[model samples]
Structures are given as structure tokens and as C-alpha cells.
Target: MAPVSHAADRVQSLDVYLNACKIGTIVRTPGDFNAFSLDPAYRATGGTPVLSLSLRAATGGLRRDPRPLAGALPAFFANLLPEEKLREAMEKHHAASVRPGNDFDLLAALGADLPGAVRVVPTEGARAVASAQAPQPPRLRFSLAGVQMKLSVMKNTGKGGGLTLPLEDGQGQYIAKFPSLTFPGVAENEYANLALAAALGMDVPARELVDKADFEGIPEEFDTLSDGKVLLVKRFDRGQGGRRRHIEDFAQVFGLYPSRKYDGAAYHDIAAALTMAVSPAAALDFVRRLALCAVTGNGDMHLKNWSLIYPEGDGPPALSPIYDMLSTVPYLPADGMALTLGGERSFKALTPSRWKAFANRARLPEPAVLAAVAATAARVNAEWWHLPERAAIPAAVLARIDRHITLMLPILAECGAG
Candidate 1:
């Protein structure tokens, strides 16, 4: 097990990496903000940068000497760590009870493996993982991004497509998500939803449902799901040979707290974010994604669901592959959309006129936006009708989705999408 460190004073500086190559450094300043600066070596030989180290492209854009970031840490660094609730398993089984809200401290504790290549340890323990290649003891502990409970495991090319092996301290190429005990068949639902998105030409990561019984050994922590299937999603951020890709969710990019992800931001704000941080071409992709989300009944596409991927870490930014796509309307009939569209919270109110007005407000080409909305709605509706049986979606869930689509047909027609 990795030793947990909470001494905020012990951390002085953090080295950041991209694809296992050093890119920058973060210095600690207790009781104040953390300071980050691009490594002079990295900045000197920079070819094409994607990560954008901060919201400002150049150090001159920031008034601070070293570009001190928000949330007591850099926005990007804070995003590397998962939501507070998502770390319960790590705290309960592996670490100190004291909740060190400081992200630098948490990064110090889990030094060996993290989401991206931006690995950090105290300058002293930074070289602590020399024996990382050795096989580790089996344990029922894990750390993953997002607020959901998930574990990182692997499936090799052996018999039965290889049994699920917990990554231990090594990085995992696939993330295993257990079905929600309170909501039966959620794993299957997410798998089917993601598969549908991929079929619709959305850039989605590969995912599938793995039967729990296929595993020769099941961890005790996952005993509640022994009778069902678990969703295995390929981590888009991690690639072949354990290389890590950089990514930032909308919440982090906008400098909003996870608690305020839905309360403060709307869909247009996301489009506007793309306009400023990325290019107009990338903004058009957001249009198709938003339109598809409307037809798919994925009402829970909150700020955290959308992300900007830095393929080369310091290269140009593009929309990240979609994940966490599911029909939330079925489970929470009482809940509405997580964020508003064109100041309209009611999905039924999104008429053609409303969308046209949204396009004008977001400064996107009205014709392109309209065409994308009409085309995507038509395509997704037709494809959704044929997905239930093929994806093995539960009959009851399929029925709800069918009804949900029916409910949105009139709305789509009002928008001249039919």
C-alpha cells in the first residue's frame, strides 16, 4: 500500500509531465495559492502545445509572477484528482482519516499512478517507483476520476478474454464500473448508451459489459454485484504502453466548483467556452453533441460529462471522446435537464425559433447549427428505435426510453427536425 502524507508543509514543488516527459512545475505556498510555471526547457523546444497549461496561453497574460491558479491549486491539477465523494474508498481503506482538501497533499500521497502523465511526488519521494514493474499483492482498493465509484483493472489476451486483474498501483487501461445497486442494470444501460453514441458517429471510447461470473476471483468489495454485469470502459486518457493523455472537464476549464457545475453553467456557456479556448470548428462539434443529447434523453449531461482532450498534452485542444452517456430520464422521472438550453430548462420548449436564437447568442453559424440539429435528431431517432434488442437493454428500460423518445418527437418536429 502507498503511504499517505498529509503534511502540507512537506510538499514544496511538483513536477508535471506529458506522455512521461517533464513539461512544468508547481510550487506550494501554504495559506495562499499554489504557483505553476512551464519548465523553461519545455517552453524553449515547444512545437505545438495542446494542454494550454492555464486559461492564459502566455505567462504575460497572467499578472502573477508564476501564474498562481485558483482553488488553492491550479485548475488543471485540481481536475486531475477525482471528486471528493469519489475518493471515499481510498480514504477508508488506504489513508489517513483527516480530509486533506489540499490537492497537492493528495497528489503527494498517491504518487505512483494518476489519471494523466502529470505525475507528482514530494521532491524527496519523487523517485519512489523504481520497482513499479513488479507484480503487486491483490487488494480491493482503487482511485479513479469523476464522482462515481469505479476501479481500474485490466483484461489481457488470454483465455476467456483474460480475467479482470486489478491494476494494484500500476496504471490501468480499462475502468470497471459496477452497476448501481439502487438502480438495477445501470452498467448494461451505460454500455448500451455509449455503444449507441458510437454508432451515431460520435467520438466515443470503446466499452462493453462483462459478466461478473466470468472472473475466476471477485474482490470482496464488489460482492454486491456478483450476480450482474459490470461495465468496462476503455480509459481514453490512457493509451498503449501506459502513455497518458491530458484532459480537462468543463467545470475545471470554467473554474467552477464541482458542486456548482450544474447550478451556474448552461449549454451556451459551454459553446462559448469552446469559442474562446478552442476554435470555431470545435464549437460546431459541440452543436452536434448537444443536439444528440437532446434526442437520446440523456438529461444528466452536466458540466463534468463534457471534456476537452489534449491529445499531445501541449497540442491543440479538441473535444474529448464522450463517456458517461445514459438515459437518466428513465431512472429519475421527476428530474429534468441538468443544465438549461437557451435559458429554457424545459426540453419541450426547445423550438426551432429557440435554437435559432441560441445559435445567434452563441455566435455560431445559424445554418450549420440548424442543419446539425435537424440531421442528428432524425438519425438518432431512427437508430434509437433499433438499438434496444441488439444491445440487450432491459425490456422495462427500453420501454421507458421508447416513451421518452415519443415525448420528444413533437419537440423535434417543432424544431423542424423531423
Candidate 2:
């Protein structure tokens, strides 16, 4: 009974830690702005409101204790680096020790790397760059190039806390992410994968890893040698100069329609959400790309991981920047695409028969769909090996990845042209 009781308490503590890891704005003081709280369903654990972030700028060091949520969360993230590497990174880049005490000084420290979209004004009305506007709490704040941003907590929502801030300088907005302690390598992995995708000519958000000590919203403990780092990417949705509308996830745009569930309506709604007329041709193209992703070993393609972005002015919405792109299947044994194809769970479902069936159901020309599949396969075969090598992945792992890619090419070729 005593052991059980202890375990229960431990779980509760992890929950609190996980909840605190989410991304949100830090108000200088509580009640400075309206309190916006998400419902319980938004969290990984469906108990209390996992995230209670304030939207307004707050003062102090911008800190929150994670001890409370330590139990419900895992001690480490799935498929990250070994524990030792994480420990070394945390020690080398302790955020607390490097941060300035005030926002103005922090902004001065961040000099030129700041994005052009955000502008940081002085508390007394003097316009500073972004770092000067950081909300001070128990967290450490710093500037990068002059943009004001924080790394306070990871939002409980699985959306990964990527945002496009409006800065005054250039049109480029920032994309921020707060990873959990459980996933120590998430920041580095995301950075690496983003680079990989870009090199492959896939559209991805411009991204980089900010030193934890340089951001005011991140807590000192989180930036400590023992704590993990967060990953931040630059947003592309912003207009030429920072004047852009807010971005929306597919679920929000599609209403109650479930993306993981394949149906005629699902296909139609997806095309409509992109503001493109539904057609068998487009569906085949979309599915072929997705199948290519699977062949390349990306198994984390859930609905929320994809989005449709509307840029400034009138134009049909296109696929949002490719994100959350990873070879999850190779790293995490349990990882797989969230949606099934032809009643099969793995990428193997991209069989000729299944592809034909899906194409027929979507009212697409089977030949076009098959051609798309062949193109994707050819692209994978031609470029896959060169990528891992240039990325400096270990030779052994690269070999395994090549084998997997090779295995999928035959199946993709088998999909007959309509």
C-alpha cells in the first residue's frame, strides 16, 4: 500500500511538469491580461487544465515550478538521444547563468539576429527590439538579433508551440517550440530534420535552435545543464512585411470532420479546406506524396501534424510548410502513421491493389495517381542516400535507411498507371 501510494504521488508530479512544459505568453504579473485557459481535453493526460499560460507580458524571471507535474510525464522522450548526451547539453548551455536581469539589457545582448517582424518597445514608451519586451518572471530572458521571445513552458497541446510573431523589421515571423524533458533530443532532431527536408526541396519552416539562456520565457532550471533545450523555427505564413493573419490547424478549418478517418467526405473536406476543388487527380497526388513519406520511413503523419496555410491576398490555400517530418518508424518502434491505408497499418499498405482501390474511391484517374507514385519513388531512390550522408548520420544507420527506402521503391513502381 505504501509503495502504491508513493507511485501515485509520483505520477501526479510528472503531470504537473509536463503541463508546465507547454508554450504560452508570460504576463509581468498575474491578472495583467485576461486569463485564457484551455480545456482538459487539450492535454496528454485528461485530468486538470494542463496549461494555464497568460497572454499578457509579465515581469519577474518568468518561471514556473515543474515539480508538480513530474509524475504524470515520462522521465524522457521517445527516440531521443541517450541520457548522457542530454545531460551534457543542459550543462553546457545553462540558461539561468547567462541571462541578464532586465529585459532592456537582454535585448541589447541579442544584437542583430532578431527577425524583422517583431518590435520591442521600452516600458517607458521607447521602442526597443523584441528582447526588451520579454515578460520577466522566474525564467531567464535573452535576445537573439533583437527579437523578443521567451521559452517559459511547453503548451500541453500537441501542436508544438510554433508561432509567427509580428516584428517591425522584416516580413519573416518566428516559429517557436517547447519540447518536454522526456524528449531531450527533440530540439536537435527537429532542427536536423528541417534541414534535411529543405535540402530535399520540400517546403519547411525556416528554423534554428536558440540558446536557452538567451530567451527570457524559458526558466533557468529548464536551461540548466541537467535540463533539455527547446527548438524554435521561423514561420513562413507571415506576409512580406509581418502583416499577416493568424494560422489555423486543419481540424479547426474542417470543423468536426476527422482527418484520420478515410471517407468520401474526408477527401472532399480536405480539398475544400485547401480551397481547391475536389478532384480524383488532386487526391491521387496528395496520397502519393503521403505514401512517399511512408516509404521514406516517416511514420508520424497524424492529422494535426499537417496544415493548410493561407498567405496574404487572394489565393487558394496550399499545403502548409512540411513539418514534424521524421523517420519515426526507424527510431521509435511503436511509431506509425496515424491513418491507415487499405485497412493496413504500415507503409506496406501502399500496395498496387490498395492504391488502385483508394484512387477509385476518390474518383481519381488511376493512371495519374500511379504516375505520381512512380515519380515519388524515383525521387526517393535518387536523393535518399545523398541526404543522410551529407547530414553526417552514422554510416550504419544510413545503410539501414537506404535498405528501407529501396524496399519501398518496388511497391511504388508496381502501382499501375491509370
Among the numbered candidates, top lDDT falls to 1
* Alpha carbon lDDT of each predicted model: 0.67, 0.41
Off by over 4 Å in 2: 1-172, 176-196, 208-217, 220-232, 239-241, 256-285, 388-400, 416-418
Query: Over the stretch 1-418, how does candidate 2's per-residue lDDT look in tens digits?
Result: 1111111111111111121233221112222121112223333233222111111114522223223221111111100111133323322232332222222222322211222222222222222222333432222121221111222122222454432322222232454555544444555555655665666566777666654543433334333343345566655545443354323334333332232223313432353334332234445546655765667677656544555554344344456677666555445644445555544556766687766665565556667666776777776666666664235433444455566677778878786444
The C-alpha TM-scores of every prediction are 0.83, 0.51
- In model 2, what lDDT does residue 150 have? 27
Clashing pairs in 1: 49-314, 49-315, 50-314, 50-315
Instruction: Point to the candidate with the largest TM-score.
Output: 1
RMSD of each candidate relative to the true structure: 4.4, 15.1
After superposition, the stretches of candidate 1 with alpha carbons farther than 4 Å from their true spots are 1-13, 27-48, 57-72, 96-102, 125-143, 159-161, 165-169, 215-226, 276-278, 313-315, 388-391
Q: How many backbone clashes does candidate 1 have?
A: 4
